[model samples]
Target: MLKGKRILVAGAGGLLGCKLCADVLSAGALVVAADINLAAMDERLQQHGIASDDARVARVSLDLSDSSSVEQFFCSLTDLDGAVNCTYPRNKRYGAKFQDVTLADFNENVSLHLGSSFLFMQQCAKYFISNQRPFSLVNISSIYGVVAPKFEIYENTPMTMPVEYAAIKSALLHLSKYVASFMSDSRFRSNCVSPGGIKDGQPEEFLQNYRSYCLGKGMLDISDVVGSIIFLLSDHARYINGQNIVIDDGFIL
Candidate 1:
């Protein structure tokens, strides 16, 4: 869906990010796969059979936490059609149970994730305004952002939905809308994709618990969310702005 377009996949080393890079490249977009870990990002791309010298894809390093790095990255770009922010920055204590979360940890995690998202959105909007081109910015959110967590699903597992995650993601959806509205331009679009639990080696018990709430698939594979993202990046969704597309089967129902 994204042929001939130049799309940037930040956090390209990550699970969803890597898959996104490969799929978009497959669809003929010139993919700029970027992450702080350049080597790892390259490795992930290779794992998907995308060579470093592919010409259609470029691997670069980007640290979303640093303002100068983000500014320089945007400044260096030209003719960029779309970008996705998949970077999940968090402190060491990120996944602590709700009751076990410290105030400091909560504040820091929020700052790292949500704060960086704000910076990214700001830079993307600036890029659209300066270049005077159509640009789409996709923010990865979670189903937890749209609905309260089902604590029962994690009953026997070591996971409890982190308080900080809920705060970050829910805010991201609104922030995307805020940027789109602030831009007030049909050319600049900002949207979100909120996916349910992606299978990442969670206990079978937890998986079964999760499946009970879904209509069909229990947990989505990383690939399940890619098509929607690519759609948002392409002209097919040119009029779809400031909307949150949830890919959670029927979990939220």
Candidate 2:
């Protein structure tokens, strides 16, 4: 669906990010695998079947938190079709308990992740606008952003939804809406995908509680999100904009 296209996959070393890169490459788009850590970028590319000399794949170190870096990165690209941002920036102790949340951590996360996300989106919009081209941007949000977190699901688990994540993701949906409508003027498209809990190694008790809330399976895998992302970035979805497509397996219902 994305043949001959040039797509940038930010946070390409991450779990969802790597999966998205593989899928985009399979769809025949030139992927710029971008992440902060260059040391791991090559390994991530190799894991996704991209070789060092592969013309279709380019590796770049991106500090999404840096505005100058963001601008320079976008400025360097040419014939860019679109981008997918799956970057999740957080401090060292990210998963803080709800009551244990601190203002310092909250502000740092919000400013770092949320602020960087805005700069990324805005920079992409600016690039497309200057080039007078049509492009699509997909921002990864969360199901928690769509609905309040179910504290019951995390009852026996060692997890509680962090306040900063909720704040950043929920606002991201609105930010996509704003970028799609307020930035482009019909030339650029901005959309969001809000995914539910992707199973890693959560306890059975948490998984069971989570399943009870789902219409189908309990949690999602990388494959579940890749297809939706490809469709959104493809020309077939050219008409889709200012939309938040939720992929939570009915967890929100």
The candidate 1 region of ten consecutive residues with least summed lDDT is 52-61
How high is the lDDT of residue 32 in model 2? 91
RMSD of each: 0.7, 1.1
Which regions in candidate 2 have their CA more than 4 angstroms from the true location? none
Per-residue lDDT of candidate 2, residues 130-249 (tens digit): 887778899999998898888988887788889888889999999999888787566599999898999888888988999999997979888888899999999999988999889988
lDDT over C-alpha atoms for residue 133 of model 1: 87
On the 0 to 100 scale, the lDDT of residue 72 in model 2 is: 90
Clashes of each: 0, 0
For candidate 1, lDDT tens digit of each residue in 24-81? 9888899888899999989988998888888888888898989998999899998899
For model 2, how many clashes?
A: 0
Error at 115, model 2, angstroms: 0.5
| Pairs of colliding residues, candidate 2 | none
What's model 1's lDDT at 49?
89
